[model samples]
Target: MIPRLVATDLDGTLLRSDGTVSPRTRDVLTALETRGVPVVFVTGRPMRWVDELHDDVGGHGLAICSNGAIVYEVADRAVRRALPLDRAIVLEVAARLRAALPGTAFALERTHGFAREDSYRSRHVEPVGTPHGTLEEILDDTVVKVLALHDEMDGDAYWRAVDRLVGDLVDVTWSSTWALVEMSAHGVTKASTLALLCAELGITSAEVVAFGDMTNDIAMLQWAGTSYAMADAHPAAQAAATHRAPGHDADGVAVVLTELFDLP
Candidate 1:
């Protein structure tokens, strides 16, 4: 069936391995929008990281960001809505996680940008974020998501461990393969926010087609009526999706869109 809406994750899914969108994918999305089928980018990236992607969705499209803590409008270059973790909950979760996992670094994804603990060293310099500061100083205000970075553990192991500790307390997820964990307020996820948006648009999950390539996209893949897991997708994501597409480097999502919509 032709989907009324198209939802896709960014990293490792719609983007090439180098983290750039291919011209073909961009054009296909723009064409879909022209045809009255809205394309939504659902990702774990924060608002700061998404500012440059305004032209990706024909310069004006909605994005579900920060694993569902934010809804950004590309053209307007504004956050239409922000769902931040309660400061009290953030404090409680941080304390419990620190005690459970020694040497873990903490960071906050604020509404405007990012901040982190002084000792925290990200795998790469974040495109946008303040220099390191004390955890308390970084989190002085409410934040959309909390980051838990570990030095010695692998991504899968550390995430599972965090799940064992605070899975019930907050929404835990990760998009990249690095030893990083992201937490949101409980019950928040790409799927939840997308569902709300779909409701507002008078669309149903069955009329939506979603795509992703990581563990963070599992809930969304399962929520859509038809889901595409990129070829290099995490095992859980592949298991959750209704179908599989080529790797992002191969323009897997574009291949599927072409088939589904008869795009050139």
Candidate 2:
């Protein structure tokens, strides 16, 4: 069946290796929009980051940011809903991580922005082109996610330590080299957030198709009607998907969408 909605992950799923959408992929997505099929970007990125692509990809539909912690409607430029982090839990987890991995860089993601300690500026090198902000100002608002960024640190080891220490209090996952760890409230995830959006759009889980490529995307990949893992996906992500596409650099999403919808 042709899905009524196509929900996709951004960084390593839909976006190419260069972090840009290919012309062919963009054309296909635009065609999907023309057909009135909602294309929702379900990503670990913050709402402000989503704005960077609003004029391009988001012109077609809403976005699910912070891995489902918040949903934003592009047309109205308003937050449709939000699942904020528990303030106490966030503080507790942050304290524990600081003690366990002293000198490790960390950031907090709020419904509208992201926060980082002043020390993070000099010690950590962000991914090329990604933005940064101050933690003090950001924490004054409702937080939706927390991230740990460190180089030369064993990501799996850190994740294990975090799980052992605060796993019961938050949801933890990673999208890239263990250099980063993303945390959300105990029950908030991309899957749950997408389900809510499906209801709002009067669609059903059976009519949704999703694509992803990392541990953070597992839940949503498994929840879709037809889930696809990128060819270069992590083992956990591949195992959770119903099928596999080529790879992000290969425009895998567009390849799968065209075949699934039988589009020319």
Candidate 3:
């Protein structure tokens, strides 16, 4: 059966290793959109980090960002929906993680921008946001997600340890190659958000195809009827996917979509 929708991740799945979309991939997606099958960029990136990607989506795709905490409408350049983390829950989670993993720093993803603790070290050379006071002082606004950065371990190791400590309390996931973990409200994930969007579009999970390369994409991949993990996807993501495609450098998603849709 032909898929009615295509959902994909950004960092290690859709974008090339150097962080740019290839023309072939862009053209194929445009053709897919023209055929009435829309593409959705489901990612761990905050909205502020995804602004430049508007055109690649052809001004028609919806972006499921912040691990499903936000749904951004590409064409309108507006937020269709925002699922914020509860202030009390966030504070509790932060305190718990801090106690368990001493020296760990925290950051917050606000509706419009990002804010981090004074001691948090951002992996990005370009800082994600300004230093707000301690996590306690940053609760005046709604928090969509929380970023946990640990300087003593790798991303995979940190995620595993964090999950073991706080997995039952909140949703913990990591997408990048840094020693950082992202937390969302329990039950909030890319798959959950995408499922809602699918329903709104009159499409079912069985009619959707998804792609990803990180642990964050595991749920989304498992939820889709047909799921692809990029060749270099994280172990968990690869195992969750029904199939595997070339890595992002090879335009894995485009290759799969072309075969699925028989596009030129």
Q: What lDDT does each candidate get? A: 0.88, 0.82, 0.88
TM-score of 1: 0.96
Which residue pairs collide, candidate 1? Answer: none
Error of 1 at 259 (Å): 1.0
lDDT of 3 by residue, 1-264 (tens): 999999999998999988888998998888987898889999999886778777676465889989999999877878999988888788788888889899889888888677888888877754544757788877645788999999888888899998898888778998878889999888899999999999999999999999999999999999999999999988889999999999999999999999999987
Candidate 1 segments whose C-alpha is farther than 4 A from its true place: 58-60, 127-131
Model 3 pairs in collision: none
lDDT of 1 by residue, 69-92 (tens): 998887787888888888778888
lDDT of 2 at 103: 65
- The TM-score of predicted model 2 comes to 0.89
